[model samples]
Target chain A: MVSNIEWTTKEREVAQEIFDRAYERETGALVEEIRDKASLIAKLEDVWQLHDYLSAKRHNIDGKYDFRDAYLVFVFSQLVKEGWVELNELEDLSQDKLKKISALTRM
Target chain B: MVSNIEWTTKEREVAQEIFDRAYERETGALVEEIRDKASLIAKLEDVWQLHDYLSAKRHNIDGKYDFRDAYLVFVFSQLVKEGWVELNELEDLSQDKLKKISALTRM
Candidate 1:
């Protein structure tokens, strides 16, 4: 297991701010309109999920950007700029798929 | 603001199991190798960030996938199946972009 690097309180706060602002700018609405702050913070935590996987993969490389940081700076920023899809829609989609899969299993 | 639909405890547990198994199957290693459970849970929270945005966009569409669910089922599943790009590499790429942007700003 690669050693985990926890995001400092300051880092988390900053990242959250960036995420919120970008999200608002692109969608033209505040994040709180649909979800609460606690919920948003919870989701932001996933940014670190892939950190260990990436760190191990890039262990041999020099001067790498921290996985968590890169996700915020690049992938996420792009997602915000492009506008993100909604959670309810995604859940509905999942239900649909689950039903289809269930039907197939019963057949 | 669209009505928020929170994931139930059961839903969260089920989603995590699916995410973890899919991740391990594709990476040939468990997620715990690099990050802890708490961290992984945090990241998964983000699947909901775009929900409001997507619902508003697709509000008129009949029989559409929820953004969050679609992300898990389609986008995330594809990422796992395709062998996700290492987070570090994405970070490195981001750093390169940042450096270039910084340089341009300074010029």
Candidate 2:
């Protein structure tokens, strides 16, 4: 269920950069949301609400950043779908990988 | 080994209250810490530092709050050791439980 396309050394570096940038962009938004929520947490119960939110967000982001070569297509697709990555940023990747990521993003 | 002493209805209520209050106190401190750190988190990596801290704290607090009657003595000992629960607050438990918790806290 994963893409097994071969990647060159340059493609690997490009993929990693794209992934890091996407992670930084998305997590920056999450931290902003957390800062706002944390400031409003006046009660013990309100703290649990923030805890639950961060738990879920951490799980989602952890899954998204699974950077195994076999999973990069799926990862990139999710980043694109979430607006954390643009199509042109992935141009350094093989056309095969890009096509797969594009197809998955649409799905 | 755990305490097998039976809990009377009143004892159970007292136990729950002490446990909850201890939890509220400890987590209140944690929330305050998070608020301060979150305000100062200026970079993506700083957010991950908070993320790691929360993950570890959640694991620790979750383990401490298992709340089964069989495990309450051990739980109370930990609470006491951490200064979240005082010995006098546990007076409602049986002498056997109180003694065990008191002894464990010293360890």
Candidate 3:
């Protein structure tokens, strides 16, 4: 049976590094220039907030978890709307298919 | 004796409402138009992340907590640099002084 997760520990590290660098770049006087400010932040917040919520529920691994699953789906949907990431052109995604997409990122 | 925390449950509720409304308004196509996007999100992330961190450490209350404390101080420093909030003009603040400013927001 396939797992629901797709993102590996490696991808999480890369995302975290990219995210951290992005965060450092944004914190200073240059903050006004980043793109899709509110929505991006809100989406970032969604992921981070969910991480927070889940961590409290004891479901996270040191603030990072598998992303190619439900969380990644949620993130992909959010990013797609903002033009940060793309959605598949051929079909509208169902929850089940989204789940399958998530399975692509697992370890 | 004065407590270090100044934000009341009332303030937290108001802040939460403002924050939630702000959040809802930003989550869609309009996300790109928001100001100081990265810095604001980073700051928002800081607050929410702190809330998450603290809550996981068991210090948060229903996702909101007192803001006129260390967390608020940290947030204020972040915002002031972005021109979202102001720092006291006459005085160069010491950490102790910052703590006093925080005391002003307590219930």
Predicted chain B of candidate 3, TM-score versus the true chain B: 0.28
lDDT (tens digit, per residue) of candidate 2 on A29-57: 88788777777767756766776777788
Give the runs in model 1 whose Cα sits over 4 Å from its true position: A1-5, A29-74, A77-107, B1-107
Chain B superposition TM-score per model: 0.28, 0.89, 0.28
Say which docking band candidate 3 falls in.
incorrect
Listed for every candidate in order, the interface RMSD values in angstroms are 13.6, 2.0, 8.2
**lDDT tens digits by residue: candidate 1, A1-107:** 11232445665565565555544443333222223222333322332333332233234221222236333333332343345422222232234332332333333
Please identify which of the two predictions, 2 or 3, would achieve the higher TM-score against the true structure: 2
C-alpha DockQ for predicted model 3: 0.09
Candidate No. with top lDDT:
2
**Could you give the C-alpha RMSD of every candidate to the true structure, in order shown?**
28.6, 3.9, 14.8
Q: Which is superior by lDDT, 2 or 3?
A: 2
- lDDT by residue (tens digit), candidate 2, B17-65: 9999999899889878877877886665776677678778888998998
lDDT tens digits by residue: candidate 1, B1-107: 11232445665465555555544453333222222332232332332423332233234221222236323333332443345422222232234332432333333
Each model's fraction of native contacts? 0.00, 0.34, 0.11
Candidate 1: Cα lDDT at A104: 35
In model 2, the fraction of reference contacts reproduced equals: 0.34
Off by over 4 Å in 3: A1-107, B1-3, B17-69, B85-107
TM-score of 2: 0.70
Among the numbered candidates, top TM-score falls to: 2
